[model samples]
Target chain A: MGIYLPIAEISVNVFVLLAMGAAVGFLSGMFGVGGGFLITPLLIFYNIPPAIAVATGANQVIASSVSGVLSHMKRGTLDFKLGGVLLAGGIIGSTGGIYVFAFLRRLGQLDLFISLLYVVLLGTVGGLMLVESVNALRATRSGAAPVLKKSGQHNWIHRLPLKMRFRASKLFVSVIPVLGLGAGIGFLSSIMGVGGGFIMVPALIYLLKVPTNVVIGTSLFQIIFTSAYTTLVHATTNQTVDVVLAFLLMAGGVAGAQYGAKAGQRLRGEQLRALLALLVLAVAIRLAIDLFVTPPNLYSLSAADLN
Target chain B: MRAPNAFATAVVLSLLAATAPAKAQVPLTEGIQIGLSTDNVSITAGFSGADLTIFGSLENPDPLVARQGRYDVIVVLEGPPKPVVVRRKDRVLGVWVNLDSETFENVPVSYSVATTRPLQDITEPNSYKQLSLGASNLYMQPADAGDSPATIEEFTAALRSRKAATGLYSENVGGVQFLSQNLFRATVRLAPNVPVGTHKARAFLFKSGVFIKESSAQLEIRKSGFEQSIFRVAHNYSFLYGIFAISLAMLTGWLGRVIFRKD
Candidate 1:
């Protein structure tokens, strides 16, 4: 079936979009990520304009994040205070990112900038996760316990001024790093159409020393609002959000997510992380290749300064 | 004197007789007229490219010339004009970047041409340039005239080729056929991504490779369907639309979790 996307002003196969969404959703569920990072690039590869892809990806992230957050809320692993502080910074950063997005679009460099950001960020994050997971897996196979970071170990981040205690995570951390991390993720969310979960989860674990149990829930909690804000801004300013496209993806994503979550339970954490790392690395490599390869058509046309 | 006067009268009579057929040989100037059944066409969401048939007539056409296939007609459907920027990507530090750009003002969003014969066979290329009849002949005015002629020419060629590739600018040979000496039907293409605005349908008449007359009509191509309504809402009431989109996402998320809870 074919459906016309109002904002994108194009007709795309409904089944292709649904399947793309389902595949991304399955991975997101299996990996406990928002899936925005995957969807935006996939949409671009599928020939959706990068601007619309980014905005619509942000819109679709809300559904998966909300679904994930609900499970976390029920389990009582969510840190509301930390999530709230992150959200405060996210709104500000997202606002700035939207301006930059519009500016780059006008300059006709938004696509390049988006691809570059994805390649750099995803490649680094994926590489680090792969190495860490492989080491952990090796340790387990050798009948040795995996070395864990002590929660009480003090880092420079803990020394920062104006520290606030997060009761749920059982930690006192400076508001500055928390707010800064939130702001960075927020920026990425608006610009890259990602919930920044891949970055946020690891950052929370290593940088902020947030407890592993509460990290995913708290990251997801903040991601829901940040992406929601990003969607609203892109909609109002760029008018690029295609609800029809977003809806189809969400429908497929939500259904696939449930089954994926069930399937994920059978896998060990290290194996799951390794698989997700490979997936991320693959996407990053794909995007990087496009940047270097010669495009068939060098000349492109667009409406001049669409108002 | 009588002989001379009679000779003069006879000469005058002969002159009048000789000039009579010459005066009668004057051909009537041909005129063209096109009419549309409706001023507006509403295209639904499933609108792929379709051929629009326009009925027209040649007024005061000479039967002898029409029979010889000397009468040619070219019909063009031009969409609304808008400013467009064409950018060229250049390899920089192993990455392709949009490095150069040229902007053209009042470029037609779409132009589709239908002709009784091939454009080259119907008339001289100079005539096409003079009338700006075909897509290739249509002048694209650069916003910055200060740019070098070579650069402007390059960009203009690029723009036209890109438009042609996208099916926005097209030419159909023998798309116009004469039903009778005076009546003709033209079939012009409307691309799937046709711009929604007032489109101008123009027909040009040629007699023996000479420009005779031209007629034009206006058509409003509107996208009318559920998708169009959503587009309107998104642009007109963007704030509310944004809120709605967010709410819809949240609803879908909550519902999906409720319906398909794994734990």
Candidate 2:
């Protein structure tokens, strides 16, 4: 008996699906990333519609993050309190973002909007990271401090109403601020159909000034929860989750993440950031070009109506 | 901290930038091409079409290459709105077997399919649905009510009979047929005992055990003037677009930090 999938037009093999999962898993593991950025694009390249790709990527991310989160927990690096604060904000933001996501999709403006944003963000981020990391390397060689010396000054997040102390994460932040941050991150996650942990982690570290050690752990905790929620919602609503596909990708991702984490350990913090920045920039530029440039194949067909 | 050193470094950087050149592109003309035409021959429902040729750069152009082991193209067809069913058959020991397209479902219709080349592996197992008249069991239409224009049973029988005689379908109802070695036709023949109305058709092609191409068309099977309609309702739509725009901005912000933000 044949299993019927809602989306049509292409019938791919189980092995091919697994290989795609493996490729994305390797990249995610290597970078300590959620892999949605790359996975969505690759899926689109293979003719999977964007809506399905984003929803399905959320499913795969839950499993991909398992091994990475476990290792972080084992090292006693998690800051559950801080993660909870951000997650609260993110959840609200995601709810709002979903509304926007569905709206844009119906209007057929999703691709253009996504591409433009990627271009601006990627180019700026890549350029800045490359410059900073290279400068840090030069400074180190010259016997200068890698980071500028400064008073441990507080940021705006510290000044908001309803202050609460987070003992494990070493933070005494305002509840309102945490909620606001979570809301913003949540919105992005929902709209982009990505985990948004990469952004949330940095915000916690630099904006909130949480210590470096807790940054990854906190992000993973939040990611685990948010993605689980997203997966359940999309599965129940759109029936988009394909456990077979997700499992294949997860198997590859877990193995890749182990190696990636090890490799990450060997690189200097500045060097790693610089390399990652370059990669982000490249993808951003490619996406931007796609938006502005006329496509080679101008006419296409979608099999969605076949149902 | 020295002025001379800074000036020297700037010169070196400028020189490096000037020396870099754009990478070379691969030209498409360098690739070889091949021509293909339909090889006339029909395979019964139990068989597959077995004539196809490629007059291009064969890796080994020797005529003995046919027996020395080579690839032969097979054209297979199924149902209207053609779900592509074709594949490349690798010849071994003078017999061609479709290594592609491995699965078949449903059991209906009586069938027979004949081909010019000897099939490599041919068997009629309970699980295997034959490509010939036997397929009518599945393709056959359901019985209609009394005084109905056409009954499903009569439609399947008529199509089955036509297929047995000429390997060509005249009615516009749904059935699978192979026209030539390189070309296959999947048609939807309207049953003589059925009602009159518009219907849809589809076709698909396969290569190397995977579906490679497909096409679909909507045709009115009725004998009447065409009916068409288009409705557009415009309302407040920018809110969603605005949200997408903002979400993208946040992603960009996050990406920017990822690339440029200091750790």
Model 1 C-alpha lDDT versus the unseen true structure: 0.93
TM-score of chain A of each: 0.98, 0.88
User: iRMS of each prediction in angstroms?
Assistant: 1.1, 17.8
Q: What local distance difference test score does each model get?
A: 0.93, 0.49
Tens-digit lDDT track of model 2 for A169-278: 77777888678877876676555556766566666767777787878777877876676666555544444444434554555555555556667777878878878878
Over all chains combined, what TM-score does candidate 1 have? 0.95
DockQ of model 1 vs. true complex: 0.65
DockQ, all models: 0.65, 0.01
Tens-place lDDT per residue, model 1, B159-238, is 99999999999999999999987899999999999989999999999998899889999999987889889999999999
Whole-model lDDT, model 2 = 0.49
